[model samples]
Target: MSPRILILGGGYVGMYTALRLQRKLRRGEARVTVIDADSYMTYQPFLPEAAAGNLEPRHVVVPLRRVLNRCTLLSGWATAIDVAGRTVDFSPHRGESRKIEYDVLIVAPGSVSRTLPIPGLAECGIGFKTVEEAIHLRNHVLAQLELAASTTDQAVRREALTFVFVGAGFAGVEALAELEDMAHDALRYYPELKADELRWYLIEATDRILPEVGPEMGRWTLEQLRARGIDVRLGTKLESAKDGRIVLDDGTEFDAATLVWTAGVKPHPIVRHSDLPIDAKGRVKATSRLTVEGVDGVFAAGDCAAVPDLTNPGEYTAPNAQHAVRQTKVLADNVLAHLRGGKMGDYRHAYAGSVASLGLHKGVAQIYGRRLRGPLAWFVHRTYHLSRVPTVNRKVRVLIDWTLALFFRREIVALGALSEPRREFELATRDK
Candidate 1:
């Protein structure tokens, strides 16, 4: 029987591994199967552009079936993994739960939004991880302007136009900057809605934002955001968000219809269901080679695995797309080496500098020991991510979007109905 290689989660690691295996291994050598909850691989870096109306939402995600044509694609979620038995249990989109035995396993379930027990968060706030959220935010931001324009009441206008973001990392800063740019531009269409009337607040518990980009870049980012009339509150945390009323730990309070939570992400809880060894943070204990500790034929990578950072002592790799993509290459090569009776190689990558976009045509970056700010850094930010976005088709589409944005205005249509597909059904089924 051919070796059955099962990869869980179709994120960076899963998709790259399956693609590499399909290319490296000859036909009938191994049966590769990839399972994921979603049918698309989201290029997360482009999410801010998608939210800001700079790029189309559909272009930010690649359909898995179209990309991974060689492998068996299962659109489902893996519920449990029995490492000892070499089998995986998953719940498909339809039908009964099923189990599939595998000769080798790759666990890369990735991460989810790490939320807190703060009041009204789950009921009121939105996460900024998925493509759906980006699209929804784009529409919602535009819709807020519409609401502000239609309402004569000052309080109603204030509430509708207020936007709050929690966390100052890349996700929060970029998202806030992009949306603020979009909202400011969108106000031109609404005579009643002034750019100054829209309240934009960025709350962070830490003293600085964009820690990955270092202190100097972070300070520059703060100044840039403040210059744009953003209320950037550092060393402050969100205490509560009940009924869209935000309460900061510093005793500041305000009502905002738009609250985005981009604080951080935690490992997928599905890692706990597996018998594989896990670290204190609940991530799979993986060696430098990306193999599960004490478990042969099982490998792990991406956000779900605690793969050691060889360059840094007493530290594992940080969960970022930069490391994830680089690690995927090593993991793929090692997986191929293992199959061909060749020696597996270790994963060792030096930390690369970080860059961030502060709205369109504005950016900060420190790369290869060189510091850059303003348009140069912003151009570098776009150039680097565009290069990394994957596939020639997507690259061309994204480039075209960028080229068109130079001459044309951004589209700021809010389709809030995208969030709730069964809104009418829910309303009709409601008890009167």
Candidate 2:
């Protein structure tokens, strides 16, 4: 009988692994089954651009069924993995729980936003992890502008216009920068609102921002943002966010309708529930060869796996798209080699560097120890990511989006009603 290969999650690792296996595996060699909550794999690096209306949201996500046509795509949640029994417990979108047996298992559910116990954070703050979140945030930001423009109360207008973002990582920085640019561009249409009135604050617990781009670039980014009148409070932490009131450890207090949290990410919670051996950080313990440590016929990579950094012996590779995308190639190759009784190679790629877009025509990059900033870095950021974002179909679509953007003004219209399409219907049906 052919081996049944079960893959958990359809994000960067899981989707790429399945894609590679489908192409490389001989007919009847293995049955690849990929299970994920969503049927589409989001190219998360393009999320900020999508939110800023630079790229269509649909283009940023690859349909699993479309891409992994050869693999059995299961739209469900992997509740538990009994590694000892070689069976996984899964629950579909609307069905009874089922157990699936597999000869080879790959766990790559990826990471979730790492949040802290700050007061009222769960209710008050929003995360920047998914495409849905990105779209909602964009709509919410634009809606806030509308609210500020038409509101008569000074406090209400002030609260509506103030946007606060926590964390200085890529997600937080990029999202904040892009959204701010979009909002700034939008101000030309709002005769009642001024650009200066649209207050933007960036709160980072650390002293620096965009640490991936080196200290010099980080400092330069800080200066650039400051020059644009963005309030960047470094070495600050959010003490509380109760009732939409942002209280920082630095003694700053503000009532803002918007708060974006992109502090960091932890290994997906499924990792802890699984029978796989996990490191102290709650990530699957992975060998340098991309196989789970102390386990046979099992592999792990991406954010969910603590893959040892061969270049830096005491540390694991940083959880980022750069490493995740590269690791997938090695992971797929190793999995195939293992199945065929061939020698598996170690996953070793020295940290190439990082690229980050600060907004339209603004960015920073550090590649191969060389640093770049401004429009050149921004171009480099787009070019590098454009090459990396999976599929020729998406690459062409994204290029067209960019090409069209050159001559077109940004579409700033907010569609807040999309989230509550039934609200009007329900209200109309009710007795007035």
The TM-score leader among the candidates is: 2
TM-score of 2: 0.99
Flag clash pairs in model 2.
none
Error of 1 at 296 (Å): 0.7
For model 1, which pairs clash? Answer: 139-414
TM-score of each: 0.97, 0.99
* Ten-residue region with minimum lDDT total, candidate 1: 186-195
Which sections of candidate 2 miss by over 4 Å?
none
lDDT of each: 0.90, 0.93
lDDT of 1 by residue, 1-432 (tens): 988999998988888778778888888988989999999899998999999989988888888888888899898889999988889998999999999999989998899999999999999999999998998888888888898899888888899989999999999999999999888888778877667888899999989999998898889889999999999999999999999999999999988999999999989988999898999888999999999999999999999999999999889999999898899888888877777889999989998889888888999999977889999999999999999987889999999999999999998677777788889789989956
What count of clashes does model 1 give? 1
Off by over 4 Å in 1: 421-432
lDDT measured at residue 172 in model 2 versus the true structure, 0 to 100: 88
